[model samples]
Every structure is written in C-alpha cells, then in structure tokens.
Target: MKKMIFVLVYAITTLTIFSFGKAAENEQLSIALSGQYARKMTDASKKLEELDTAVKKTLLFNESDGSSKAREDIWRLSSDIKNSVSSLPLDQSFSTSWMNYLGRLGNYAKEADRVTDHNEYLRVMGQASKNLRAMADEWEVATTGMVSGKLAISDWTNRLDATKSGHDWSGMGTTVKQYTESDFPLTASESDSMKKKELRNMPDSEVTREEAVERFKKLFPSVSNEIIGVETSKSGSPYPFYHIRFAENQSIGYIDILEKGGHVLSFLSERPFGKEVLPFEDIQKKAEKFLADAEYKDLVYEEARENNTAWHMVYVRVEPRYGAKVFSDTIHLKVAKDIGSIVGLDASEYIRKENTHPQPITKKDWKKFFHANVQVVKEELAYVENERLEQRLVHYLTVTIDEHGVIGTYAVIIDTETSEVIKTERLQ
Candidate 1:
C-alpha cells in the first residue's frame, strides 16, 4: 500500500510540471510573433517613404537622372515590401490579406516602371498612388477593428482592376479620369468621324496640323522629336483635341492644341529651363505670383499633375477685402506649361453672392463658439460653385479633440477676387 501511494504522488507532480512548461512556451511564441510583426511594419513604412521621395523628385525635376533614380527606388521598395510580408508567420490572422494587398501594390509599381512615355507614366503613377493611399488607410482601419482585414484585401483588388482596364489613350487630357469615364475606346471609324467634326467646327484662323508644328518648332528649337495624338471626351461629347509631345534626348514635354480649325488653345511643357526639368518649386512660385494681388489668405498649392498638359490645381482662402465673408471661394487656374501662362481661371463660386457675416444673435453662438481642447491636425482648401454663378473658395480644417471624441472639420469659403467671408460650416 505504501509503494502504490508513492507512485501516484510522483505521477501527479510530473504532469503538473509539464503543463506549466507548455504554457510558458506558448506565451514566448506569441511574444516573438508580435515582435516580428512590428519589425516588418517598420521596414515597410520606411520603404514607402523612400519610394515617395523618389517619385516627388522625378516629377519635380523631370530629368533623366531623376527618372532613373525613381525607377530604381520603386523596384527596391516593391521588393522589400514583398519580402517583408512573406517573412511573416503563416499562422498570423492578418497575414493572408496583407500579402494580397502587397502583391497588388507591387504589380502597380512594376507597371508604372515599364511605361516609357512620360505622360503615360504620370497617369499610371497617379492611379497607383491613389490605390496605395487607399490600401494604407484600409490597413489602418482593419488593424484597429474598424473594418475587416479580409474586406480590405477585396477592395484593393477591385480598385486595381478599375485602374488597369485600358480605354481610349488619345483625346483631350491624358488623365485617367477623363479617358476611363468617357466614351473612349471608340472604334477607328468613330475617331476619324470625330476628327472631321472638329475640323468642320474650327474657326478659319486655326492653323493646319503641319502649320502648327512648324510654328511650334520655331518657338522651341530644342524639340528633336514630336508625336501627335488625339483626345476624346468620355461622354462622346463633341469636344476632342490634338496633342503634341516634344522630346530632346531623354527630356520630354507636351503641348495641347485644339484641333477645331487648328487653333492653339494651350501650349504646355513639363520640362523646366536649364538643368531642371519639371520644377514644382518654380510652378508654385508662378502660382504665388499670379495670386499676389488677391485678398485671399492661407494660399495653398495642391493637386498638381504633369500629363500631356502639365496642370496645377491651386486652392487658396478667399478673404474678401470688402463685403460679406465667404470661406471657400476657390480659384481653379489651368496653366499652360509650354509658355508658363494661365490658360483658364474659373471663379464661378463667387458669383452667388452671400453675406457670411455673423448675425447679431444666433442660438449656436451662445454655447461656446469654439472648443478649447480641440487641436488642428489637417487643413485642405478647394473651390466650390453653385448653379447661380455663386463661387465659394472652401477651406477644410480638421481638428482632433480629446481621445474619446471624433475628429472635427470646419469648411469655409470666401470671395475669389475680394477676399470676404462667404460662409462657414462645421462637421464632426
């Protein structure tokens, strides 16, 4: 009886020890996985930053050297992201979805690198950037449990499909939005007919294609090569235009000339003078010069694109010098890059006259007009217009309050020329 009792006691003690050891081992494994995940994320973020810097340099300089550097940077970043994602443990709950998103991003970067045409490259890159930003946002939400990680993967793939589908390459504006949304991908006969219509409606002063080319050559002696292309509207509208791409060695530029009666509506080039190619800094300077006399405050440069027609969409605060204050009376200037001239400025938002001056008494004003704890995080300016020709320059200011509260945003617009308060609205 004593021997049996001793054996039973020993067995119980050994089993207890084995259970504790197994639990400790499992906890260590979990900790290691978390650390690995964090490292991979950090590496991915660093690579992304590098890729962005390279892209900005290429767009701003438009130099062969910059382009080459950007290409290499993109390739390296893609490879690193891919490898980092692959290194993640297969048992990770989010691993499969994250891997899919990274793969799609890699495909976009690869496609962008293959594009030799400057305009095409810009268009592709723009689309890719949008997709990347979306993916990043989705990832954040998924990790925070605001959205499902699996859903994020599906959404990214859908966006990729939307971007990769090719439509008509020719027509006005090499922008993907313009082409994909239009009745582009038209038949050859349809394209020819559209050309005929353009020629018929053109004014007599318009020069022929050959004549325009001759004039352009005289103006830009360095133009070693030229390619002609046509642009069609997405809705099959009668608005179609011809484009000319100029090249000097590895440097390239573009000019958009209306085909209607062959008039040169706009001449643009992405290439900058001297050693610089596409100098965004210079572009910003030009924009600033153009807005010097305007009464607007908080002037901002945003949404610049270098496509067949290098264009910059600038958003500035419109503080009216006199009259009622409107917050977001924005001005949209379409600048011609070839000549560095403003081709069009749309300020239709100011046409709808509104007096935004605070009334003597308002119910909301009495309840603390401003939140003291809120801190501004981000602000964006844009142009908004109504049918009554009333244009409002809009300023969107986002703020973060206490950790428990949602972010708040304020939208304000002002007059275009005379900076005056037009209106202010808040959102949370």
Candidate 2:
C-alpha cells in the first residue's frame, strides 16, 4: 500500500510540472510575436509617411513641372504599402479601413500628375498620415511596456482582433462616423479631368537634350556614369526638358532639366536622409544658396513648412520694378532636416514666369480704390490669379469693416490694372 501511494504522488507532481512548463513556453512565444507585430506596424507607418511625401511632391510639381515616372512611382509605392499593411495581423475593422484607404489612394494617384485647382486628394492624404502616425506611437508604447514586463502579451494580442467597446472609429480618419466604407472625400471620377489637365512652364533658356544630361551629371557626379535613360518631355508640357534617370548599386535617381537653359526642374534620389543634426536656420541657408547657384537669385523666401522629415521652402519672385511679390512665379526647395541636405528642387514656376513684370501701385493710389467706410490697416503687393484664370498684379490690403453689427478684419485684393476691388476674404 505504501509503494502504490508513492507512485500516485510522483505521477501527479510530474504532470503539474509539465503543465507549468508548457504555459511558460507559450507565454514566451506570444511575447516574441507581439514584438514582431509591432515592428511590422512601424514599417507600415513609415511607408505611409513616404506615401504622404510623394503626394506632396505631386502637389508641388504636378503636370506643370512633375515627371510621369514620378507619378507612376507614387502609384507603385502605395500599392507596395498596401501589401505591407495586409501582412499585419488586423481585424475586420482595421483591415477593412486600411484596405479602403489604400484602394482610394491608389486610384487617386493614378491621374494626379497634372496641376489643378482642386486639392481634395492632398487633404485626405494628410488625414490618413496623421492617423498612421498615431497608430505607430500606440504600438511602440505597447511593445515597450510588454518587453519591460509592465504589460501582458496576451492582452495586447487580444486587441489585434477586437478594439475596446465605445472607441471612436472616426478618429482613425479612414472611415465615416458610422465606420461605413463609402465616406471618402473624392469620388473615383471626380478628379479625372484634373488628372488630364495639362500645364506648361517655359524655361528661361533652351538647351539640347545632351546639354541637359550634362548639367544633371554635374549636379550629381556620383551617379553620372550610371545614366540609363534621358526621355523628352511630352507635348503640352510648358518647357522642353530631358527626363534623366540613373540606376546604380540597386538604387535609382531621377531629374528633369530644361532643354533650353539646362536648368533643373526637379530631382530625386532613393537614398534616405540621415539624422537631424543642424538647426532650421542653417538648413534654410543651405537651401537659399542652392537656389542662388541655380540662378534663382531674384526669388525671396515666402514660407517654410515641414513634412515627411523634410523642410520645404516656398520662394516667390520679387518684382524688380514694383517691390511686389510675384507669388505666381514660385519655386519650391526641399531640405532634408536630417543631415541638412538639399534633397529636392522644383523651379517650374520660376522658369515659366520669371520675366513677368507687374505695374506699380503706390500707397496713395491704393487708397483711391478702398471702400468709403472701410479703414485700411495694412497693405502689401501681391501677384494673384483672378477668377478668370488670369495672373494679375494686385494690392493685398488688410482692412477693418463693419458687417452687420460686427467689426471684422478682412483681406481685400485690388487689381492694379483697373484699380478695381477684385476680392475680399475674411481674416477673422
């Protein structure tokens, strides 16, 4: 009887030990998976940021000065990013939202090469980027917590398929308030005409295709020998240019230069910008110098905005005669805040309208056009396009006016040609 009892006791003990060991092994496996999931989510978030940058490039360059290959690449990258998202462990809601967003993004990107007045696509892309950034932050926090033993891996995994009840889906910005799939800003066919619109900007000087390629080589010596293609710009394009491409060491680069002056309209390389080490002023100076060397000395810095790890500066042509800002003759330069490198340049507008001259309107002359009851507070020269799509020189006036019982500040644009009030926009 004593031997039988000992055998029973030993069997029970062994079984308990085996079960505990199995549970521990499963826990470790779950933790490893959670880490991998977080990493992929971070990667997807990064791809989305790249997509946002491509969209901004489209906005800045478009058909007027952008390359067809660049537009095509945007489509390709979005597709690749969508595939990346699919590899993530998402539930019905998350997967459905992302898929829908990527599908619409790919469709919009197909015909977004042209310049147009409508910018609904860009606005929507900005919202999507914001949501992706938030998701990445949340994942990072969860991963850090789990690895440090502050969180349970099992708990994190559960949320992959099921979000907590009462969470707002609209905050994700990819779905409607009710989480329906049909609430995208742009319909499939709405931007079709915009995609087909053609914009042309004539360059200040004309150069041969050979000369354009040589100019690009000088700008990027490291890849000069790797030139593979130099295609001509299509008809309806404002300036004649050579679309040059270089492929080396598994990386590719692209540049568009005028066939006349050999001026570069745009440039892009596949290399990543490194860490941010320099201040904004230092980076801005570098960009300014780049524009100066490129023969854009007459342009004045208007504003600088940052996105996708780069600072993009918008420069406007200063009217040589009137001291007015020719906003229509613009240029865009992108400085990689990381490593303080000038990574992009778009001078299509400056090339097209650099010689534009605006008539002068003195301070006293502007008063003759002001409304009788309006009080002028500030004034500046501005080049604006009218409703008729005609570029005009105007005085951008800030004024105070009483509208119905409310005092408001307004911005009024007066056409310098006819001294007529063209438009008034509320400032406050």
Candidate 3:
C-alpha cells in the first residue's frame, strides 16, 4: 500500500507541473499576439502605405523638372520604406524577396539623386510603385483582419508565401555592382583602363609625414597643440595618406592628409556644439579665408545647403582666362554651424583631374554648336569630365523638350570645335 501511494503522488506532481508550464506558455503567447508586436505590425503596414504614395508622386513628377527639395523628400521616403520593410516579420522565403526589392529601390533612389534621366527614372519608379501599392493593399487587409480577431498570424504567413510565389525576385540582386562602379578607389583593371585612356598624366603626391602634420596644425588653429599620434598608409587606393590624431577640447580629433601633396583631405572632431553663433555669410567668408590660406583660390560655390549641423557646399574651380566655371575641378566641404569652423574637406575630384587645361573657342560659338533636336535655353562654357576622368571643353546648354506631353530639362554637352555631342544629362 505504501509503494502504490508513493507512485500516485509522483504521477500527480508531474501532471500538475506540466499543466502549469502549458498555461504559462499560452499566456506569454497571448501577450505577444495582442500587444507591442501586433502594434508594430500595424505601424509597419502604415509606413508601407506612405512609401507607396511617395513613389507614386515621384513617378508623376519627371526628375528633370523636380526641385532639389522634391528629390530630397523622395530620398527620405525611400529610406523610410527600406526601414519599414526590414521591420516586417516575414519568414525566410518572403524576407529574402522583400529585402532584395527594397535594396533595388534604395539604389534606384541614390542613383536618381545624381542627374537622373527622365525616361529611366519614370520607368523604374512606375514598376516599383505599382508593386509596392499592391503589397501595401494586401498588407492593410491582413493587418486589419488580424487586429480585429478575424485572422491569425498564420493566415498572413500563407499570404506572404503567395506573394513570394507570384513575384520573380531572382533577377533583383543586391546593390554590390552599383557600389563598385561609383566614385571609389579604382581596381586593377579600372586603373589600367584609366591610365591608358587618361588625357593627361596623373601626378603623385610626395609630401613627408612631418610636413602633413604641420599642414594639419595650420588648418585647425583652434585645436590643441599636442599631437597624439601620426600614421601613414596607402589606404588601398592609388594614393598614400597620413592619418593624424590630435586633441581638441579634451576630445580626440583626427585628419587625413594626402602623402604626396600634404593636402588635408578630411577632418573629424568629437566635440559637440551647443548653438549656432555665426551667420551663413560669415561661415562662407571663413571657409573662403581658409581655402585662400590653403592656396585653393578663385573657387565658385556651385551649390550650398544647410543641414541641422553644418553647411554642406560644393566649390568648383574657375578658369581665370575665360571667366568660366571648371565644373570638373570640384571640391566638397562642410562648415560646422555651431562654431563656424571647417569640419570636412574633400578635394579628391579636383586631384583626379590634374593639369586639365581645356582650350575652347569663344562663347559666341556656343549658339553655332546647338543641335536641332534640343531647343537651347541657356548656354555657358564649362569643362565637363567623362566617366574615365577625361576632361572636355564644351558649350553646356540647358535645354528643354517635350517628351510624350511631359516637359524635360537637360544639360547638353557639345564638343567645342567639332560640334559633336559629348554627353547629355538631366538637370533636377
């Protein structure tokens, strides 16, 4: 009788524990299904709807006619869409497809930022917008039903599977190719091609590390005097540079200087700013003074915009003889809004087009070279750079034409003497 009682007690204890464990699991799952996770799903669906609408608007506006602000908005919306898609709770099969699509969309938006063509932008945006709208509609239906207790998460799972089966996502690969082709250090083949095709021989910078250190000191007079460290490396590029670390306001600051020329390529500071004290005009003056001190003279600011933290600017070299803008010789810089100090300088593009002297005819010849296809509205003399870093003297004509009831603006680059079309790019 004692052995039978012990066996019965063990059985009862095991059953009780098992039943409690099952109940706790059910409760936790109930919380997950109804609370934060469910709300996140709904939010994600709404963001998708916003993205679809944004893309539709972008499709309607030709890139050539859209303002810079419009392009910025589109870029921001594309980023939001990518983030929303990433937050979705999809299984492996669907997640992979959706991520690939989002990757393409992000890349398309990035490329569109740099002189996007009208027909190309329209084509890409149309397809992507249509697909996204369809996905958003489906997501809304599933999310609404799930929240109302009419649909299960598993039902959404089946819909995702169906979506994946319907779309052929194999052609949509990652954006690795676009990254490789953009402005970056050249590969072996690319370098060889560039060397073979270059109009002028590329010069090498041979400045010593000590000279670079002094240059950095001169560039940032406000920084602490003591240098923490100095190192040099090829940086996997054709050029070598010195990476210098210094102290600024008890914070670690750094700068990269080209080894050949002792030019400050970039700089960074960990110090945070409290408020903006100097106006934009003052900031521009400071930047001009700094550039003048560094011997980068006669620069024309091609573009300037202010963000939350700094003034982003693009300065181009001007041809002194002809008084024309040499757009190929460009430098990018940023002025911190709070301190009105130079925070960044990128002269890589200028360095790439070394010794590019374009010999062009008089400005009056511009009208003679204008093609019959495009009605030239405005013409200016500017040095244009091609893909292989080759510079051409061209009559840059900003022209407008009607394309299937849509008006489009384009920059037509006509060769100086030959009157042949060098290239054409859309102007946003």
Candidate 4:
C-alpha cells in the first residue's frame, strides 16, 4: 500500500512537471495535446489488457455460443482502441497499416459466425491480442516523447493528421487474410458492404460523375483546383459514391460524394492547425455555415467538444410539425479550431429514409413516473430508437434527484405509449 501510494504520487508529480516545465514553455508545442497524450496512453493500455483477456477466453471456449460475451468484448475493445489511436499525431507511414490491423481484429472476433477453422481463429486472434499489447507500449513511448519534447516537434505535428485515410483499405492487407473472409475492418470493405446492404433502398444513381465533382468543388471551392482524381465505388455496394482526392497547400484529403443525389456522404481534410485556435463560438458558427452551404436543413445542436485540433459536434434533425428531435436522423461535423475549416463530416445517418414512429396517443405525467423527491427541471418530446431499430416517441426528461445527501442530474427517456422509463443517462 505504501509503495502504491508513492507510485501514484510520483505519476501525478511527473504529469504536473510535464505540464508546467520546459515543454510547456516551447512556443510550437501544444500543452493540451501533450496532456491528452498521457490520457490516450492510459486508455490504450486498459483497452489492450481487456482485449487480450477476452481473446484468451475465446480460445478456450468449446462452442461459439459459450464465448459470445468474450467475443463481443474483443470487438468492443478493438473499436475503443481504434478510436483512441486516431487522436494521436501518428506518423503518416504507419497510420494505414495500424488501422488495418485493428480492423482485422474486429472481424476475427466474429469469425465464428462464418464457421471459420477454429484452430486458425485461435492462432490469429492470440497473435493479434499480443500485437495490441506491443502497439499500446509503442504509443506509451510516443506519449512520453510528446511531453518530453525529445523528438523534433515537426516530426509529430508537421502534418495535422496522419489518420483519416478513407475507404481505400487496399494496402491494409493482413497476414491472416486466409483465415476469414470478413477480415476487413469496420471502416474498410466489410462494414461498408454491410452498411450498404442496410441502406439498399436508397434512391438509384441519377447524378453523373461530372455533377458529383461540381458538388465537391462547390463545397470546398478553395481547394477545388487541388483535386487530383475521382474514383467510383463498387457496383455491388449500396449507394455508390465518387471518391474525390485533393492535395496541395497543406490540405491533403478526400471527399466521398454519392452518385445518386450528389450529396456529400462524407469528407476529411487533413492539414496543420498550429497553436492558435478560434473560440468555440466562432468554430460553431463556421460549422453551421458549412452545413447551411451544403443545403442541410432543420438541424439543431445541443453540445460540442474540443478534440485538440478540431471541434466535434452532433446535431439532430427535428420534426417541424411535432418539434420532437429525431435522434436517429443526425449529422456529425468536425471543424478545425485553427481556421474553423470543416475538416470532417458524416451525414450518412441523415441520408437514410426516415423511419416512421407511432404518434403519441397521450402525454404521460412526469410526476407519476418519478419518485416523490425528484424534481423535473425540463422536459421535451423526442423520437428515440428501440432495441430493434424501431422508432418510438418518448418523453425526454431532465431531472434532479437527491439520494440520502447527494444530488444528481439525469436525462431519462420514457416511452409515451407505455409510460415506462426506457433509458436513463446521467448528464452530470
């Protein structure tokens, strides 16, 4: 216990020193990202440990049904690692290959569904879990490098982002390719095909490739001339898109435009965002204008977060007549804080055909649903999805509850049709 206490104090002391020491004094270095690096390292370590444990359990299980929980844990942890790895200032050369590895791990977790050879699955997953541990260690070293300023600042931050390589997972081929056909990652080929199947009912392609290019140019007129090439997606894929690539003037990225509606399905622009950044309000305005320019309508935001170089935000579409927010139909945006440029966008959720929900037969009384001591602070109508992906109108409640002595605020969703508390999420 004494040793544990001493180690905890030492870790905290080291972090404080790093935050206020010579590294913080460096003009070109970012203290926020340096601090964030420590967090990402810790997260990676925990996730890798969980993933390895889950993989070990799966290898011992006699039947696939018996290992369902462990398999889900493997997939979830791999996804968590993939997201954490994305925040780092990854070297461009290693980013693609690393993502490919993470993706294959997720597919391997579900290989039982396809009746893949159990021996091969056991071998590949065991090795993959070990690889994750090593990767986590390397990331920990990189985090230290960031805080110590031992490596040249330009080496990590020269290009703003080394991530966001897009759907071109051609080079992310894995050694375990022969073990399972679903070895492709979630962001790569397999998930795309699956998602496309889910969205198979989307309107047919009527917009020409030339028209898609014009749309892309209009959305980012400044870098339109920098566009080098545009390629078409697979015919078998649902909602075929034109993958447009652009580079030059520090902006190297791609935009995927649907061939049917010329809608900007998704886009990612990678470039340096130096130490200076605009205020959050300005960033919000910039993102709003870009969405407006894209002709997206009736979107409203409730929160935004700063993610080092960019501000991540989600806006839900509201039904004009009912004023109920449709949580299923949403748009996610990422705006670079440096110049408020729309660096990333994903409107795939919005593009899906609207699912109808049963209209509220009657509004439920909040007082009856809550405990006597609970105080309702706010309430609104919302359309939330159920376990089966079916939509249902619900009473979105924000309330304060005092338990013994402590008070907590929570957001509760009550199904209007049955007056049952379906979900409860702590807001603070």
Candidate No. with top lDDT: 4
CA deviation > 4 Å runs, candidate 4: 1-197, 403-407
Candidate 1 or 4, higher lDDT?
Answer: 4
Worst 10 residues of 1 by lDDT: 165-174
Please provide, for model 3 over 1-428, each residue's C-alpha lDDT reduced to its tens digit, 9 standing for 90 to 100. Answer: 99999999999999999999998888678656655446766766766766677667666665444634444555666566556556655545444555556555655555475543677667667766666776666656545755565545555556546756333322222222232233123434346446533322446647887788788878777773778889887556555678888876654678888776676667777667658467988989888888888888878878788888888889998777667777866788888888788877777656554344557574454445554555778877777765434466778888987878887899888767556577888977
Instruction: Give me the candidate number with maximum TM-score.
Output: 4
The runs of at least 3 residues in candidate 3 whose Cα sits more than 4 Å from the true structure, single-residue gaps closed, are 1-205, 224-226, 234-237, 250-252, 357-378, 387-389, 399-410, 420-428
RMSD of every prediction: 23.2, 17.2, 13.9, 15.1
- In order, candidate lDDTs are 0.48, 0.66, 0.66, 0.72
Give model 3 RMSD, 1 decimal.
13.9
User: If scored against the real structure, what TM-score would every candidate get?
Assistant: 0.31, 0.45, 0.49, 0.54
* Model 4, span 93-136: residue lDDT tens: 45556655666677567655555576766666676656555555
Off by over 4 Å in 1: 89-116, 144-428
Candidate 4 accuracy as lDDT: 0.72
The number of clashing residue pairs in each candidate reads: 51, 8, 2, 0
What order do candidates take by TM-score, descending?
4, 3, 2, 1
Could you tell me the lDDT of residue 405 within candidate 3?
Answer: 83
